[model samples]
Every structure is written in C-alpha cells, then in structure tokens.
Target: MPFAGFYAAAPFAWRVSHLASDFAMAWFKGWSQKDQRRSRTVLLSGVAGLAFIGVTMKRVPPGHVGLIEDWRGQLLPGMYDDSGTHWVLPIVQHPVSVRVYPVKKKLVKEFTTKDGKPVEVMLQMKMAPKIYYVPEIYLRFGRDYGRSFLEQEGAIDVNSVVSQHTFDELVGDNADTEDIVDEIVSRIEDAAFFHKIKLRDPNIVFRDPNADDDEGP
Candidate 1:
C-alpha cells in the first residue's frame, strides 16, 4: 500500500476502531524508513496543524451564547476561531464535538417591596443558542462558558431596567410579577444584542408568592 494509504489505514482499525488513539504516542512515524524524513516532517506538521484544528475551531454556526476553551476544556469567553480547513486526511474525524455548555439562565431573586419588604421572586430565564447558533455558542464561550456560569452582574443592570419602571409594574396584582420579569427579559434580549437567547413571557409566580394560602383570594 502507498504510504498515504498506510497513514490512512493507521487511523482506523476494526479492533480498536480509533487507530489514531493507538498511534497517538509516535503518531508521526512513517510506514517506510526509506521515505524522506522531509515528507514525514511535512506530513507530521500537517497532522499537527490538522490535529489542533480538528480539536478546535468548530465549523458549525454563529450568534450563539456559550463558553470556549482550548483542548483542556478550559474556559474562553468572547473568543472565536479565525479560520478552519477541511483536510482530506482521515487522521481526525469531521463533526468532532466542540465542547460547549450551552448558555442558559434561570433568574431567582428576592425583591424588596416599596415598604422595604423582601419578597422572594424566583424567575426562570430560558436562554439557549438559537439552534443555528449552538456551535457558535461553543466556539464563543468554550466548553464551560469557559468555566461554569458567567458573572451575571446583570442583576444590577436588571435592577436598572426595573428601576426605570414603577413598583406597581413589578409587584402589582393586576400586572403580575411574571409579566414584569418578561419585560426585564426583553430588555436583556436587546441589551445582549448578538447573544442568542430566548426569553419566554415570565409567569406570575414560581411557587405562589403569596405569604400563605390562608389569605382569601
């Protein structure tokens, strides 16, 4: 078999299935000693390049919200790959999973009433990469946003959005707290801009904000 064929075959074996892992140690060694080391070097170099590219740089999508990282599953936020190549080499597979924890949030808070009363306001923030943007979310945020949850200082910002309106709007019986939260979500949707997130109309209460059911309706 040609040397190319050998390299090709080396990546796939019936027993192990992933021959690339088997040859992972001396992956660069060529089939024939007579072959010029230069070609080996070049092929190895190409392999290295493709290996890195194969591991990274998902070629899936855009407008997503997630975390990104190098091979180690480290976190890299607000990052993107410049380019990617489609190599004829089978040493690596296409559609390799780009490590990505899809972006999502559930808002939970204790709202202080005008009388300085604390009311627990639990919100469910449903934000995910709009299908088309899942891969982009991974590329942008890395595997774990790159490390667990992001710093959602948006509370302050969300408060700002809340502050713009009246107390009645937020905690009003007629208005409903969930509707108020939905409004807050809309503000976030616009503020985030390129961030792909979905905000459902917030419901009135997570688990009955009423102090107790004993109170008459």
Candidate 2:
C-alpha cells in the first residue's frame, strides 16, 4: 500500500533536516567571530587617535610667555610668546606660563630717617620679568616670583634708601622728592635686574610719623 512507503521515507527526511540545522549553526559561529574582530579593531584605532591628539596640542594665553620643560626637568632654550596655540611632545615635555605684563607690588614699612625721626612709607612699584630670563626666573623662584622675590627684596631696598634720607626731604614742599624717589627706584632696579625683573613707575606716600595707627590718616 502507498501508506506503508511513508515510513520508509521518514529516515531519509530526518537526515536532511539534521544536516540543515548543523550548517546553520556553523554559519552563525563564523559570522560572530568576524564581528568580534571588527569591533576590536575599531576600539584600538579610537584609542590611538586620542593619544595622538593629547601629545601634539598646547595653548598659551594672552600677555604671557610659555616655557617648555623636558622630561629631565631642564628648561628648553627658546621662549614661547603669548596668545597662541602651540604644539609640544606629549608626555615628554610640558609648558609653563610667565606673565609678560607689568605686575604691581606694594610695600609699607617704618624706617628711621637721617635725623633719627621715625617715618612710615608706602611704596608701590610696577615690574615684570624679562622675557628672555623667564626660564631662569622660574628655576629660581618658581611661579610666585612676585611674592618670593619682588616684594621681599624690593622692601629691603626701599628701607635702605629711605634710611639714608632726612624726614624733611620726604615731606617738605621745597625738597626734591623726585630725587629721593629716583634713588629708591634705581636701587630696586639694580637688585631686580639680576633676577630678571624690569621696573616701571614707582609711587610713594609718606604717613605722619606722630600717627598712632599704621595706616595714618
């Protein structure tokens, strides 16, 4: 009968079904491996691109100078100017900023005049580090040169110069205060020159010696 042949064909149909299922699984496994390789390649390329950008880019602000230091902690020879972007070696070198604009420093101190009279003086001066000597300045005073060197040494010079002058010379209308100011400025200038500082206009205000308060009215 035709119904008896159906059972005979069942074994052959089962073999064909099993073969198709095995082939499908093999194709899926190969496709997954290819996708994994592609993903790994993309990840590595992105990391390399970011690392390249980090090493080659630098920015210096306006009215400033950039100093480059190598991995050995030695400053580079050339001075970088202000307000521009620059390129430097990543991880091998770094940049430091030094202000090129004038920096104002003030000193208020009490000193004895030539006549043995005690006087109070308030002095203000503007100065900046020389562009060429900035690296040396950094090496010596770091980034705080204004407080570390300028204010400290400038006060000492001012006190020294004021001690040599009479009280009347500073406050008397007939006396030439400009000469006294010039002398003080010159001495500070000489001291600062070695430290890479350049001096600008200096202003002085004298307080009444008899006043009890430090900031005399």
Query: What do the candidate models score in CA lDDT, each in turn?
Result: 0.48, 0.79
Q: Which pairs of residues clash in candidate 2, taking residues 3 or more apart in a chain or in different chains?
A: none
1-217 per-residue lDDT for model 1 (tens digits): 5588777776465547555556643654554655546556787899798787666545534432333434554443343332443222233333333323344455566555545445555544444445445565555654433222222533544555554545555555654666666666666557444555344443324233555765887
User: Which residues of candidate 1, in runs, are more than 4 Å off?
Assistant: 1-68, 71-105, 113-115, 130-154, 163-169, 175-182, 198-217
Q: What is the C-alpha RMSD of each candidate to the true structure, in Å?
A: 11.1, 18.4
TM-score of each: 0.38, 0.64
Model 2 earns a TM-score of 0.64
RMSD of 2: 18.4
Q: What would the C-alpha RMSD of candidate 1 be, to one decimal place?
A: 11.1
